[model samples]
Target: MIKVGIVGGTGYTGVELLRLLALHPHAKVCAVTSRKEAGMRVDAMYPSLRGYTDVVFSTPEDAGLGECDVVFFATPNGIAMGEARALLDAGVRVIDLAADFRIGNVAEWEAWYGMRHASPELVAEAVYGLPEVNREAICGARLVANPGCYPTAVQLGFLPLIQSDAIALDSLIADCKSGVSGAGRKAEVSSLLAEAGDSFKAYGVAGHRHLPEIRQGLSRVAGEPVGLTFVPHLTPMIRGIHATLYARLVRDVDLQDVFESRYANERFVDVLPAGSHPETRSVRGGNLCRIAVHRPQGGDTVVVLSVIDNLVKGAAGQAVQNMNLMFGFAEDAGLGIVPLQP
Candidate 1:
């Protein structure tokens, strides 16, 4: 079994890792670290994991992470970089589910995240963990940088268009809406139920942090710098991200066929039938991205709708998918969960 260690066991993503790994046939949770919640049974804090895990939260120093085969950092951005080097030197594979090493340029990451990168050299060595794009790289990577929630949905929506060179590169737009859980499990005035509930408004219109990461991924596919306008919104729900992407078609082609062929082999990306509208709830609690492509009145514009559970495909589930690839397990191992419905 692949022994696993998790850093920061209290947040949404942290418990999410615990919940998913509990079902993994070839993986085991060895340690879970939390400075504040040390000595507390993990199941006590999150009852959803009661019968699944018997591990208790411990301090990082006492976690014995060096002995684990792989360690997942589900903590805040700065925390992972400060400690990843030592773990890597111990020959343990590391997967960071934060923005620590997602961006290729350290200076750019610093400007947006508002902190000096602790391990800039490791940034280059870390593979971006978007399995659809970097599957081969992730397999051999000692350090994996998991993509953010918004980037995951947006990139998947625009990937086929960019790769086929079928869209006007300079005018790409991603209008996204995410549930409140995207804000993380924090006690902030903005995230309070009274504040975020019964409200649907757009934030980060000027420049969201995920903008550059999305641009970087698309630019790499298009082989050139693409102009993109990415705006994110907060919805009243608890999970999922719905990304409505727009790009002008540079040539005439079947939009449905393009998407279907592009994702036919990808088990997690579902291409809905033509003229179908995919709902966020359809992918809730599952590591799946449901997409639908359209052409308005046969115009030059093409629209693609993509939906994913922010905490699942957008975070923990995708991390597990990467671990599966790194360890040569089935890509869907432990992630074969049906979406939760009303």
Candidate 2:
């Protein structure tokens, strides 16, 4: 079995890692670290974990994380960079579910995240862990930087069009909305239920952190710098992200066929039928990204709609997908989670 350790197992993504790893046939949660919740039984803090596993949380200094085959950092953005190097030096592969080692340009990452990178030397070596685009690189990576949630939804929606050169690279727009849970398990005034409920408003219209990451990913696929306007909104729900992407059609091509063919063999990306709209709830609680392509009135504009659980395909689950690839397991191992519904 793949012995695994999770850093910061008290947040939404941390607990999520525990949830999925518990059901994995070839993996075991050897350790989970949380200074605040140290010594607490896993199932006790999150009753949902009841009847699943009985591992107890440990403080990072005492977790003996070097003994594990892999370590997942589900902590805040800066936390992973501080500890990833030590674990990697100990022969433990690291997967950071944060923005620590994602952007290749060190200065750019620091400017946006507002902190100096702890291990800039490893940034170039750290593979951006989007299995759909960096699968081969992840297979041999010592450290994998998991992509941000918004970037995941936006990039997947625009990949086919950009790769085919069917759309104007400079004229791309991604209007995305995510559930409140994407804010993490925090008690901020903005995230309070009474404050965020009954409200639907865009917060990052001027520019979002996900903008650079999305442009970086899409640019790689398009082989050129892409000009994109990415705006993110907070919805009243608890999970999922819905991205409505728009791009001008500069070339004539079958849009639906392009989307379908691009994701044909990709098990996690489901391209819905033509004219069908994908719902955020349809992908909730699962490691699936459902998409649909459209052309209204046969105009020069093409729209792609994509949806995925902000915490699943958007965060913890995708991290697991990368771990599977790095360890030679099926890409979907421990990630064939069915979406939760009413």
Candidate 3:
């Protein structure tokens, strides 16, 4: 079995990594690091992991993670850069679930995240870990930077159109909404039940961090610099992201052509029927991304709607899918998780 370790094991994404990896047929959870709850048993802290893992949380320095084949950093944006150099030097592959290495430009990274990148030199080497687009690069990569939840939904929704040169690069707009859990397990006053519940307000409209990351992904496909207005909102639910994308079609293309031409054989992504609307609850707790296409009445704009469980397709489960690709295991090894329906 491939031995694995997780740094920052108490957060939502960290525990989520534990949830998915525990059932992975080819992986063993060797270490999980947490400074606050260092001596506590992993399962004891999260009873959901009761029978699956009995390991204890320890500090990253004392976790003996170098012995493991893979390490996942589910910490804040800047935490991974500090530990990545040492872990990689010891032949341990790293997957960061933070925004540390997503943006290729260092200045842009600092400008959005508000902190100097701890290891800017390594930025060039860390591959963007969206398997659907960068699968080949991830095969032999030592470090993979998982895309953000909003970016993931937006990128996947618009990639095919951009790649086919069907849309103008400059006129892209992504209006996305994510559940409260996307904010992470932190105790911010803004994230409290009272503040978020019964509220459907958009934050980070003028300049959200996911804007650059989304542009980076689309630019790669467009073969030109792409600019977009990304507006993100918080929903009252616990999980999922539904991103509605609008881009002017460069040439006249019917909605059906866009659907059949792009996602015909995609397993996890389903292009919906002509008039169907994709919903978040339909894809909860699963690695599925449901998409739909529509042409605005008497307009040249082609509308695309995409939905995914933010914590699954957007975070931890996607991380496991990358691990399977890196280790030569089946792509859906532990992630054969179907959506949990009502």
Q: Candidate 2 clashing pairs?
A: none
Error of 3 at 200 (Å): 0.8
RMSD (Å) of each candidate, 1 decimal: 0.6, 0.7, 1.1
Report lDDT per candidate: 0.95, 0.92, 0.90
Q: Which of the two, 1 or 2, has more lDDT?
A: 1
The whole-model C-alpha lDDT of candidate 1 against the native structure comes to 0.95
* lDDT tens readout by residue for model 3, 1-342: 999999999998989899999899999999999889999999998999999999999988899999999999999889998889999999999999999999999998999899988899999999999988998999989999999999889998998888777888888999999999999998898889998899898999889988999999988888889879899999888999999999998787666666667778666788888888999999998888899888878588988999999888899989998899999998899998879887
lDDT of 1 at 182: 92
Q: Which candidate order results from sorting by TM-score in descending order? A: 1, 2, 3
Candidate 2 accuracy as TM-score: 0.99
Tens digits of per-residue lDDT, candidate 2, 237-275, equal 999999999999998999989998999999999999999
Stretch of 10 with least lDDT, candidate 2: 204-213
Which is superior by TM-score, 1 or 3?
Answer: 1
TM-scores vs. true structure, each candidate: 0.99, 0.99, 0.97
Runs in model 2 lying further than 4 Å from the true structure? none
Instruction: Indicate whether candidate 2 or candidate 3 has the larger TM-score.
Output: 2
